[model samples]
Structure formats: structure tokens, C-alpha cells
Target: MKKDKFLFLLSKKLSNDISVEENELLTLAINTSDEYKQLADKLTKYFNQRKAKNSKTDKLRAAWTMIAKAEEENFEGTFDYAAPKSKFNIFSFLKIAAVLILALASTLVVYTLQKRSQQEIQSFNTGTTKSFKLLADGTKIWLNKNSELSYNSSFGKEKREISLQGEAYFDVVKNSAIPLFIHVGNITIEVKGTAFNVNAYSGKPYIQVALIRGLIQVSHTSDPENRILLKPNQKLIIPKALVQGNTSKFDIEPISTLDLLNETKWTSDTLIFRKEKLKDLAIRLEKKYELKIEIQSAQLKERRFSGTFTTETIKQALDGLKLSYPLTYTISNKLVIIKD
Candidate 1:
């Protein structure tokens, strides 16, 4: 219903007189959404038919606003129009996506889709909160705080590929023909059916892929020929190219940490760290609680500790951390300052 108005507007803007820039935007929206003429032709006819209706201009604008919301929710499947023959409008589909990738605007849409994925890239961002999703392939993906996952709706059809940021645990359904491929920046983790935890924070200087069950292959974009295969109970970390230097902030090896279950414990609403550096632990806590953490002393940041906490309060987490490390913290709004 709302999408119709968006398509109607696009068609009207193209047929009628509109600003040159607006026309260019609509044209780009159409091209970006889909290249299939059959789908586009059906949508063009639908738009033309709807344009003749006595719809107010505000109604069209309202539909444009709804596009952003629909994009946020990533409403699955196509709209059920009154005309069963009418297909989903390519322009409207791409316009909302364009908004999301451009600046959380359409540019946000472009940024997410510009170089990666084919067409039809849908993104899920878990900002300061964990999120769960039953993907198109029936795979259960649990994204940790401050994470993102983007995949096209036709994920299970020809290919099962998804781009990831931050951390996510996947319980993938076994699909031999269409093996799943996870894209984290330059590296790709290929798996057919497996349960694993992947930590690839955009800011973190390392990427870790820990396998719980099944097998996975980790490869880098720079070195396509040399790929590392990981077995069960193992983790693979790719040292990121830092602006400062070649050194990674964390270990760059595929080591198991069952003693702490350090990778996927957040899925159970628990934060557990076994001998993790104060700086790394601080970063994880900040993301888990959605707060800014400032450690006063550089020396204190190097302290290693082991702890577990399921507390909903940041102070409680801090208290648990203090048991092992000599640290005091002050909370000011969304910021936490820790001092030695």
C-alpha cells in the first residue's frame, strides 16, 4: 500500500515535470533496485496505472518516509498489491535501500552495497544491543552488541553469502550445494553447515573465527591462494592492517578458549573473559553495555583478568572486573572513567 505511492511518485516524477536532480535520483533509484526489465516493466505499468488516481501529494511523501522504516525493519517478501499481476516496484525497493546505505541516508545504502554483495543488499545493524535473526536460509544468527550483518534475501538460492561487522554467532542449516560464505572486510569464512562464533569488529585490529562444530575455511582477499582451514574447537584470527603499525592488539592464532567460552558466551546473556587484557575487556564491556569507557592509566590497561558477569548494570560489571584488577570507575551519563 505505502510502496505503491512510492512507485506512483517515481513514475509521475519521470513522466511529469520535476527538478532535473529529482529525476536523476529517481532514475538512479530504479537502476539501483533492479536491472531486470520484466520486473521493471511490470512496476512501470503499475506506477502508470496508479498515477491516474486522485492521490494527494502528501500521501506520496508519506510513502517516501515509510520506505526508511521498512528498510530498518527489513520487512521480508514483496508487497501484496491489489493487482496480483503487479510485481514489487524496483524504484521503491532501491530507494529505501539507498536511504539506509547513504548516510543512514540513501548514501548509506550505497556504502553498504557500493563494492560488496551483488544487488539487493539488506543490512542489519545491532547498535549498542544484541539482535537475533532467522535468516532466509533458516540459519539462526545471533549478533552481538555493536554488530552488523548484511545479506541479500536470495541468500539460500544460488549462494549463501553475508557481510559481517563486529561479532555474530551462526547456527547454520546444513546446505551442501549452497555453502555459506561470510565476508568480513577482506577475509571470507566458508562453511556448509556449522555453528561458530566470529568476532570481526570494524575497529578491532584482529578478526577471530572460532568453530564450535563443523568445519570452516578462512581466506584473505589479499592472499586468495593461501587459505587456512579450521577444525572444531579452534579459532582463526587475522591481524588487521592498522594505521599505526603491523602489530595486532590481540593474539593472531587459532587457539581454543573453552576454559572461558570467551567467544560465544554473550549469546547466553553473559560476559565472560579469561585472562583478557584490560584494554580488550574494556572495549568488549563498552560495546556490551553501549557506553564509553576511559581507562586512566596505560599501565592499568595492560592488566590481564578472568571474570564472568550477567549483571544488567554497568557498575555491576565494573565491580566484577575490580575483583581481579585494582581499578575504580566513575560513571557520567554514557561514559565510564576507570582509574588505577
Candidate 2:
């Protein structure tokens, strides 16, 4: 039942003989697997209850003895052990166990609810400009235009977690004791010291994560049972509607040079677009240039364009777009109008 492996680690931890590495492995096992976590939790309460009752090792021995005796009696069907009577009442023990189980169940339900709605939230928003932020955990984030990032004040103390809207590039520091979690809509990306780009702008068709370095585990909040581990230079895309019935929809692909550039160049104030639609490009151009762009021709809005803009003015960038695409644009004050 894999109890031996768990028992060995539990025994070491209880005896205070477990090394740091063994303790980390034990923690990882409990955190990653629901089975291990539940088993550990149950056994922990068992030992705590025994200790609280001032019971000795004989009580534990007797519990196992009762189980073994019951099994043997079932097998032999004619065994009897009517010797000396003990003070241990199985019925009373069952009542105590029931109460403990109910208490633990109640606690778990409360915890699950509280984890969703945390207080003392700290939020940052990048409006029409890219910005840099350094978290308390030493993680560096480059938030793209029109993006917002928020985390609880309990961050770095109890848990390291943040929620993101729009796009951002994260350079997370290594902290095995407290792994970082990024919540983008329904998808959650677990990071253990990695650099990644997350694009999850509202109203977008999909959410994407591009792992530039290290590793990350991506899972949907609706489909926790399904997960995808992404390595360096790998990208994962999850549909906006991540869950349909019990099915989880996602795609994992290797990142190309152009793809990586397009995903992360915005962090450095460089906008890179590849086969991007004029309508989609307009949104980014509006954010980067902080102006209104109106496409008068419906046909021109669907046209695709590819280019990079770093130190270009709004007029210069639009002129560059017109070079490859058959389009004309006029700038008046802060408004830019594009025509076919």
C-alpha cells in the first residue's frame, strides 16, 4: 500500500532524525500527491490523539492487535480469546475517531473557502506603459502595458502567490520551501525558480505560458487532476474555456526563435508581431503609443502584418506598417485613422 515508504519518513520525522533533504522530499510527497497528503494527515491525527490522551505505545500496539485478531477470527471462524479483559473500549474509540474525522473535515472545508478570498491584497497596474516590479521574494516582474498584478499581503510569509491580468514576464527566484504560483484566470502556473512569459489578456481567445528557463507546472483550476510540465524553451497554451465536462483542453509546443521573441520582447518595450492581424495590432499600438487608433476600412482590420517597434514614434510605426501592407493612416493629435 506504499505505507512502508511513508512510515519510514514519518518515523524519521517524528524521531527528529530526518535530514533537511529527507524532510524536503517528505514535504514534496505530501504536497504533490493527494493520497500521500491524506495518509500523512490521518496518521498525524492518530498520533496526536494518542499523545493527548496520555496513552502509551501499548495502546497503539493494542489497536493493531485488535485489527490482527479480527482478521484472524474471520479466517479461522472458530477462534476465541476470552482471557483477561482490558479497559480499551472499541466503541468509545470509534466515537472519538468519528469526532476527529468530522473536525478535520470541517477544517478542510473552511480552509478551501478562505484560500480563495484573501485579505490585505497588494496590487500593481501598468497603464499604457510597461513597468518593472520587484517582489518581496526577490522575483522580478516586467508588467506589460494595460496589465495588472495582485497578491495577498501574506505573500512570502504564508504562501507565495499572485494573480495576473494582461501580460507579464517573470524572473522568479529559487525558493523550494515556498514555490511561486501565478493565477491567470482559471489557469495556475506553479514555478520553482524560472523565467517565463504569461499572456492572459482579458477577452483573449487563450492563455499562454512560455518558459524561457527552468521549469513550471501548469494546471487549470477547474481541472486540477490534469497538469502539463513545461521545460525551458517550451510553451503551453490553454483554451479560454479550459474545462468541458471532465476534459481539459491544452496544447504544448516547442518555442521557436521568433515565437520567443514575440512573447517576451514587450518586456523590454519592444513590440514584435508575427503574422498579426491589424485589429489585434491596433490594440497593442494603442497601448504602446497611448493613443486612439481607428481603422475606417473593415477590410484593412483583417489584414495581417509583421514588424518590430522599439524606438519608433506612432507615425513612424504606422508608416512602417504601410510599407508592407496596402494601407494608409493619418495622425491628428492623439488619434490615428487607418484606411484601406
Candidate 3:
């Protein structure tokens, strides 16, 4: 059997589209001839190599050329001028080969174009209210509302690197040699097989690192001397530092995991607070829910509340808040104004 025919039959079988007769034919072909087995192995190797190389255009072109050459050779051997010619002659064989090549090449060209268009690098703006996911290497990353994640074509390799502007929860895949590196403001976090959350937006006053599971190492990209290793259920706070005369410094402090998880509840689309001041909790609510929350009374801002709320509508959340504090709120578009 020709390589193209074998590939067609193999693809049909793999896709579960082969008829019972075609399946039996394929089985007999493979068992009777070592050549057919070799061709199947070659096609499998080609596909595996294409995936490993990660260059779709080059691989598609190479695959089309190989298939065309194999078909031409197969046609030359299958037909004989000295043999009696039936309704199907050399012209029919050439026509079939040409049609197969044209169809395969056209299909591959369209597929390559579509894939390239979809894989283009895109940047997102979280203008006070946006949530997105950064998916790579079977890992799930939930970017908090008002947070931004930027990346280009060079993603997910020996070293997967991403720059963060706000807060995000990461479920990083396990690869000891190729660690996931996150660049947040001036700090850099290196981890291998871990789940953590990072909040380092420019508008924010402090850089926070919360490790939910696994181990992670956080260090200043500018000042290597400032390094901290965090274990599971540990948190670090990097105080906001000014860049004066090209000299910079940061103050690092450790916090409890319970507090960290409360801050990171956005990952689960839940908000939890424990006797947290209405003022302090308002800041977090705005960031997590991607809404603008304002406290009109300075004294009311100091009032504390304790409760947990799911990622519900702004109205419902505010109602829950009102139940705990003597406050009134009004929602206008994305802004939530509050007063006591």
C-alpha cells in the first residue's frame, strides 16, 4: 500500500471513522507486509517530531513534500506499461496523485494560517475592572480583576516567564529544571511545581506574595541581597520603596497564612473577612471584585466587620455589608459609593 493510502486508513482508524471492512483491510495489510508497518512508524515519527519542534508552518510543508514524493514513487511502481492497461491507466494514476497532493496541501495551508492568527500575542488592560486567565502548560492562572498579564510567542518552554502588573493566582506545573518565573514590579519569584498568589500592581502600595502550597523563592530583581524563601501557608509583604537617585530598598515582613488566604479568596471567587475594618476591607473588595468602593465617613471606615461572601452581584454583597455595619451604599456603573 502507498504511504498516502496508509495514512488515510490510519487516520480513519485513529479517529474511529473506519468502517468494519476498512479496519479488517488495515489489519491484514499491516500483518502481511513489513513495508506497511515501516510507513506507519515513519508517519508517527513525523507527527511527534513536528509537535516537539513547535514550528507548524515548517512541519506542514515538510509533511506535504514527503507525502507527495511517496505518492509519486508508489504510482511509478504500481503501474506497468508492458502490462495490459484497463480503464485506469497512467493518466488516471497521475490525476489521483495530483488531486491528493492538492487537497492535502490546501487543507494544511488553511490550518496553518488559522493557527498562526489565533496564537498571536495579545495584551489586556484591566482598567479598574477586568479578570482574565493566563493558560499555559496545563496550568491555570486566574488574574485578579484590575490586574494585567503580558506575554508573547516565547511562552512555555525550558523556562516559562511572565510579567505581572497586578494580582493573580497561579497553579504552576511541576518541572524541576524549568521553573516558573514571575516578574512583579521589582521582585522576581522562582518556583517549581507550586500554587501561589502574587499582588504587585503599580497602584498598590505594597508587593504581597502568598504561597498556598509547594515551595517558592522570592527575591528582588534589582537587589539580589533581598531574598526570602517561603514555605506552604507563608506570606511576605514588601513595603513600597521609592527610587531615589537610582537607589532603592524594600522592607519585607511576614504575615499569617489565614490572612493571606483571606486576601487571596478571589482565586475561588469568594470574599472572606474576619473583623476586618470597613476601610481596609473596602480596598480589598474593590480590587477583588473589580469595582470602585468608597467610604464617605472616615469614622465608619474604621468600623470593623466579620463575614464571608461569595462572588455575588455588587448589590447583594453591599447588602451583606450593610447587615454588619451601619452604612448605606449606592452603585453607579462600576463605582460603589458608601456613607454612614
The local lDDT score (0 to 100) that residue 17 gets in candidate 1 is 32
lDDT of 1 by residue, 157-218 (tens): 67887899899999999999999989987777889999998888878877777888888887
Q: Rate the local accuracy (lDDT) of all candidates.
A: 0.66, 0.73, 0.65
| Candidate 1: worst-modelled 10 consecutive residues by lDDT | 101-110
**lDDT, candidate 2, 59-177, per-residue tens:** 64456556557666773654455666579976457535543443454346435534654466778787887776656555778888899999865566568989999999999989899
Off by over 4 Å in 2: 1-118, 244-248, 270-340
Whose lDDT is higher: candidate 1's or candidate 3's?
1
Better of 1 and 3 by TM-score: 3
Clash pairs, candidate 2, are none
- TM-score to true structure, per model: 0.43, 0.45, 0.45
| Residue 31 lDDT, candidate 3, scale 0-100 | 39
Better of 2 and 3 by lDDT: 2
| Candidate 1 segments whose C-alpha is farther than 4 A from its true place | 1-118, 242-257, 270-340
Task: Give the Cα error of residue 268 in candidate 2, in Å.
Answer: 1.5
Writing each residue's lDDT as its tens digit, candidate 3 over 107-174 gives 46434543564445545555665353434344557677777776543345434777888888888878
- For all predictions, the C-alpha RMSD in Å is 18.3, 25.3, 19.8
